[model samples]
Target: MNAPPLELLAARGTDLLVRVAAVACAARELPQLAEELAGLVVRCAEELTFCDVYVLDDDGRVLEASNRPPVPLGDADVGWVAAHGCARPHADGRGVAIPVRCDGATIAVVDVRSAGRCRDEDVALATALAGLFAPVLSSCRRLRAAKEREHAAERFAERAVEVQEAERSRLSREIHDGIAQRLAGLGFHLSAAERALPDDLPETAQQIALARRLCDLAAAETRAAIGGLRPPVLDDLGLSAALATLAREATAARLHVSVTVSGELEDALPDHVQTALYRIAQEAVGNCVRHASATCVDLLLEHDRDRVRLTVADDGVGFSIQDVFAPGRRPDSYGLRGMAERAELLGGRVSVTSRPGVGTTVEAVVPVPASRGRREAGGPG
Candidate 1:
């Protein structure tokens, strides 16, 4: 057959491209975008004077067919094209499978079969269209993937919170019921030993004294673990009271801890914010004890007209915050990340400032919703 008019082919290809581009632009609003894209492919295939045209997924499954029977696009027909990895025509027939790549990964394929012997120009045109179509679809795919990942992460975090709560409950029960009772029993045993033993039984008295010391140590560990799980004071009192209690606990342990609060704080703050702030302070103080080894720690809370701020600072050894979250690092380093996550969930942000010699400070700022501010201003102090 005489060479097809190049200008006619070009014009036809451009018209089809314009239509497909319009469809792709509308894909975001289209409820059935895949079917719409498939329909566009079939329409373009028939209008372009080809024996047959088909669109395939990245896996080579036929997505849509034009001017050809609905035959499956299998590895047999398109695998060679993918392996050869170019927009070249098949040696045996007038067909080619052009790869459709978007964001540097193949997402689909465009296959053209022609009785007129497909030319390099035809292959080039098809390649261009495929490239355009790929990016549009790829963007959609990426958006969908991102939403899925976010939902999955949210579910995972919820599950994690549930597990953590369960663990805390179990620890609370064990300490309150088991360890505390054992310590009381041990103290009674020590008292009985002191009373029953005669003046000659000094060696037995020393053994009883040692047992009492061991019991005290175990009781301290149990309390520490239970406090780490869930601070009873935070539940019994409001945030200010809890902070005061924490400071006193640390001071009793020979760690100089001071807590300061400014502005009026009422009992109406949301539960999550209260919990997040409490947990943040808890984590920060724990880190100060474990990592800082500092003699002095400061906990500060400021609630005002617009926002609430909490700060935990320690004068001790600090670390490189950048390396703190690196993979394969110590699990204890997750303290900062966890604190940040909690603050973010409360629509707040957390910042960590540290230097090797100076010290470390963790601060969180959370905006109180307008209603809370209004209520706080009007309510009695």
Candidate 2:
């Protein structure tokens, strides 16, 4: 057969380069790129009878093939070209295999076959096309690696939150069942001893009374510890009731706290979501009383069809939110961080808005499960 003119060959090569560049630009992922490269090689090289594109992993294992009846990884030629990082022509003059390299390392292999002898120009063209694809493949590899790392970090954060919650629950149970029970028993024993005392022994009676008073104090302390670890109201009455109880307690502490429910929340939310919201509210209210020196705080719970929103606002001196959350500015903002982390685990967000001399508002919004129906709107209480 007569060889094509130099001009025709040059034009064909330019067209092939343009098509390959187009494929590279349009491909958003590795699989699509491999398929397009295979098709381009076959279409551009009219003399070739067969073409295949193979993507390889870092270990030279085949990850994907772009041809039907794909070439098997067990093929000796494929392995040889990949391992050696060089092109190889078949001894029978029927095909040529080329290794694609990126950053001085072999990343993939291309194999093309012809019915007759393969031309030198055809082999060169195949090698050049593979080179063009290297950078795209490299970029894809890095993107995949970054995504895997992000997923791993998310899993770690979730596990950390779960561990913290489990520990809190365990501590709460121990305090309620062990320490609280023992204190109650001691109080009863002291009462019985006081009753058993002789009428003439007035001093002994006073001593018994003092001992009973101490027991009462110890019991109260134990109850507080259990509540601090995990509020029983949250599990018993749900988020709104729990927040109302929190507000009452704050009020008792000389802070004017009010609870408002804006929508019907009769439907139960997921246990985790409720617990997270309650804890967030608890943290927000505690911050207002302790740090903000706020005299008045408002707790709001609003429910909609798809999400639930909780906001705690205080009218008191506020500080810079950015400075508090910035790195190394306030390491003691663990309470705020904990609140944010808890909300995040529930696929929710916690936002704090504040300015110096102005009041602060902490808000958390979390999605409701689809199975839970929306409640009717009602006047705030």
Candidate 3:
């Protein structure tokens, strides 16, 4: 039989590549990508029996084969091609082992081997294939690097939050158990001294009474400071009871507060998630009492199958969220920013809706990690 014309063979090859390009584009994992790449080599370079794709991995800096068993970097001809970025029977595109360099380092290498030697056309095709896939390999590495950085950032944020909570708890304990108690004891002593003092020395009696009043004020302030730190109720009774207590304590001069809890939230979420959601709720409620100038505030906490949602709405004079969180605009309050940061730390998000005359609503939704997913597993069967 006559060999097929070069033009027809090239056309068929081009058509096959076009179809495979779609598959390569859709592939998200390296294994699938390796299969597609292997298909390309098998279809185009039929004379070659071995095709290996080695890609740099995130953990180890060394290049590892993405398809088959590991191919040592110092194997043979492939090693030469990889180290020098040049191929034997040199073509315009270079060699099969020519390293695909990204960021001044070799990120990937494609090795095509035959039993005998690399034909001139075969070497050229292999070079062309590696050159074509170079950008893809580079892009994958970049994307993987970006994801790694993002994950590292998240871990740092989470650890920071945990450390912060521990410090907050320690500080809260000191203020409540130490300073508050001391102030209370001093107030008692002042009261007893006042009773012992003679009425004739009215000026001295007035001084003792005034001292007692100041002691009471200091005790109140100390309690407020303890409340600002991590709430003890979160550890004692969990988030639901804490929010209820928060609502009770949040009632301002004219502000009426209420809390409605839904779903089986007990032991459903990890500690970090619980802490984050509680912080968000605390900020929102504090903002309402301090700044909202509204009368009625509602706090809702819900724990669904795989997530927890919280809503805080108030019938208060609202302000523009854009104006509050805009760049270069540092308002007196960091409450809104704090809420957003807390939610985002746990792979969650917060949304705020407000109109001048209507009201302000803050809603936060947080995902439950799969590892801590006992709610669904132990739910009512």
Clashes of each: 0, 0, 0
Q: What is the C-alpha lDDT of each candidate?
A: 0.67, 0.76, 0.72
Weakest lDDT window of 10 consecutive positions for candidate 3: 372-381
Per-model TM values vs. the true structure: 0.50, 0.64, 0.67
lDDT of 3 by residue, 151-245 (tens): 56656766888998989989999888889999999999999999899879999998998999999999988988887797778888888888888
lDDT-based ranking? 2, 3, 1
Inter-residue clash pairs, candidate 3: none
lDDT of 2 by residue, 178-260 (tens): 98999899999999999899899999999889999999999988887788788888878887788888888888778988898
Weakest lDDT window of 10 consecutive positions for candidate 2: 372-381
Alpha-carbon lDDT of model 3: 0.72
Model 3 residue 361 CA deviation in Å = 2.8
The true-versus-predicted C-alpha distance at residue 37 of model 3, in Å, is 3.2
| Best of the two (1, 2) by lDDT | 2
